[model samples]
Target: MTRSRAQTRLMLAILGAVFAFLYVPISVLFALSFNEGGLPTAWTGFSTKWYGELLRNADIMGAAWNSLIVAVASTVIATVLGTLLAIGIEMRRRKGRLVETLVFAPMIIPDIVLAIALLSMFSLAGVRMGLHTIIVSHVVFNLAFVCAVVRARLRSFDWSIVEASTDLGAPATVTLRRVILPSLLPAVIAGALLAFTLSIDEFIIAFFTAGAGRSSITLPMQIFAMIRFGVTPEINALATIVMTLSLVMLAISQRLNRGSLPGQ
Candidate 1:
């Protein structure tokens, strides 16, 4: 009984410390966001003025639009390709090490390496750098993530049902449309949300490939620029909201995927 109680106390202490470490900074930022004086030591009163100012900021709005466009386009493209790639790779019993390496290279390779490589390739090919370029570059990494998520869902998926559907005289297209898609929809959705979140948060690659303009600036790029001007209550509000949204979406994605990832 003593050992159990001691262990319980130790676990609670660790958990409490972990939570405080993770949330204290965020709590401070949130409190500062509402401070009427915008000073850490002084709190005149709570106010929503920073959020209102953010709404009125044209530069932030424009950059947000660009980020949305890049995120949506990349997510759509990655979802389709990743889903198909997951199915294709799974169909192969013996995955060549090269194929595995190539498929996952974008995820493992350093961001600067991929960024520079894309820049060089684009310059070499005379591809105009723009939002489209950013979208295309995003897919290189986003697709790998989406593929991994979907592949996990497919890991324990029974193929016998597919065989049965085929034996029942359903054509390949019909079976895929009616049988495969239904089982795969949840995983596909989880992967897509994950992709969208990544595309939205991506910075280094977008910064290099965005081709030097505030016109193609993404939210993270905008936030980075704003940070150079010193942190403001407005930025704190924006950061908090962005972080909250990312965390919520990721939480939902994890819920859908559950313990299926990593072959567990």
Candidate 2:
């Protein structure tokens, strides 16, 4: 009992240290975001002025809108394609190893490598790089994530229901719409939320694919530009908002994909 207790205490200490390492800086940054003077030296009292300033900045708002557009567009496209692809792959009798690798390649590939390759492809094809291109680029990896989630849900799915629906003379489309879709909805939504979060925070791919000009700047890009000039209070506020939004979305994703996520 003494040895077990000692081991447990050591594990708990390690866990606490890990959590502190990960969240302490984030906590400090969040706390500083509310500091009126915007300096780390001392607290100048709590204030929401920086958030108000963020709201009033036209460039920030425009970049936020651009990020929203790209995220939404990419999420929608990826969800549909990924869901269908997952369904199709799951129905196969033999899953090809090479095919599986190809499907998931985007998820594991380095973002900068993918970004450069996409930029090269777009340039070679003479496609105008803009929000549209960014959406397309995001869809490449986003779909892989969606597919993974949906495929997890599919693994435990009862294929016999689909078979029964077909046996009942239900059309393929009808079976899919009525039987398969209902079961997959939670995982689908979870995947889509994850994709949206990734797209919103993604910078490198969007930067490369978004072409020249202030028109295509995303929230991440804008934040990067702001930081280059020096750390300002507005950035703290923006970071707080982005971090809060991402955490909220991630929580929802975890809830929805509770059993479907890997190593759950």
Candidate 3:
């Protein structure tokens, strides 16, 4: 009993240390975001002026709007393509190793390498680099994530229902719309949310593809530019807001994913 108690204490200590290491800096940033002084080194009283400043900053708002557009467009495209790809792969009786590898390549590849490759591809194709390029880049990055999530859900799917529907004289489109899609709705939404979160947070790919202007700059790129000058209270406030949004989306995605699992 004494040894078990000691082990439990050690585990709790380790857990506490891990949490502190991960969150202490974020906690500091969060606190400083509300500081009236707007300085990281010293805290004056609490105030919401920094957040107000963020709202008023045209550059920040424009970048935020750009990010929203990229995220929404990429998530929609990735979700649709990924879902179709997942269904296609799952429907196949012989799932080849090469095909699996290709499907997972985007997720496995380093972000920097993927970003460079995408940039090169766009250049070679003579594509105009702008918000549209960023949207396309994000779609590429997010597609694998969406596919993986939907594929996991599909693993436990009851395909017998689909077969039964087909036997009942339903057309392919009818069966897909009325049967398969309804069952996969939760997972699809979860995948879309997850994709949106990834697209919003993605910086390297967006940066490479965004090309030559403030017009295509995303929120992460803007944050990077601002932090190069120094971490001000406005940056802190912006970070806090972005982090909160990401956490909320991730939490919802996780909940939906859990609920979609068999016998959950």
Candidate 4:
């Protein structure tokens, strides 16, 4: 009994240490965002001035709007294309390993490598780098993610119903609309939310594809520019807000992917 108690205590200690390592810095940053003095090491008092400052900053607001545009556009495109691709792959009986690898290559590739590759491809194609370019790049990155999510849901899908619908003389379009799509709706929405979160937080690909202009600058790029000087309270506030939004989206996506409603 003593030995088992000692082992349990050790496991708990390790778990506590892991949690502290992961969240202590984030907790400190969250706390400092409300610090009136705006110093990392010193806490004068609690204030929401930093959040207000973030709202008042024109550059931050512009970058945020740009990010919103890119994320929404990319998520929409990726969700549609990825869903179709997922359905195509899942419906095939003789799925080749090569085809699967090609489809999921983006998810496997390192972000920096993919970003540089995209930049090179754009340059070779003589494509102008702008918000449009960022949107395309994000679609490329997010496509694999959306496909993976939807494909997981498809694995457990009831294909017999689809066959029955088709056997009933339903056309391909009608069968897909009435049968497959409705069943995949939750997964599709989950994938879209996940893709939106990724596109919003993504920095390397957006940075490379965004080109040289304030007009195309995204929130992550703007945050990078600010942090180059040093971390400020305003930056902390912005980070907190972004992190919270991402967590919320991810939580919702997970719930939907599990085919459950929130608070259920």
Task: Specify the highest-lDDT model's number.
Answer: 4
Q: Candidate 2 — which pairs collide?
A: none
lDDT preference between candidates 2 and 4, better one: 4
Go through the candidates in order and give the C-alpha RMSD of each one to the true structure: 1.9, 1.3, 1.1, 2.5
RMSD of 3: 1.1
Model 2 misses residue 169 by how many Å?
A: 0.9
Q: What would the per-residue lDDT of candidate 1 be over residues 1-264, giving only the tens digit for each residue?
A: 999999999999999999999999999987888887777777899998888899999999999999999999999999999999998998898989899889989999999999999999999999999999999999998999999998898897888999999999999889888988788888888999999999989999999899777879999999999999899888988887788888888998888888555566
Q: Tell me the spans in candidate 3 whose CA falls farther than 4 Å from its real position.
A: 261-263
lDDT of 4 at 89: 99
The window of 10 residues in a row where model 3 has the poorest summed lDDT is 255-264
- TM per candidate comes to 0.93, 0.97, 0.97, 0.96
For candidate 4, the TM-score is 0.96
Misplaced by over 4 Å in model 1 are 1-4, 259-264
Clashes of each: 0, 0, 0, 0
Cα displacement (Å) at residue 6, model 3: 1.7
Candidate 3: TM-score? Answer: 0.97
Q: What ranges in model 4 sit over 4 Å off?
A: 259-264
Model 3, position 43: C-alpha lDDT score:
75
lDDT (Cα, tens digit) per residue for candidate 2, span 98-140: 9899999999999999999999999999999889999999999
Model 1 whole-model lDDT (C-alpha atoms) = 0.90
TM-score pick, better of 3 and 4: 3
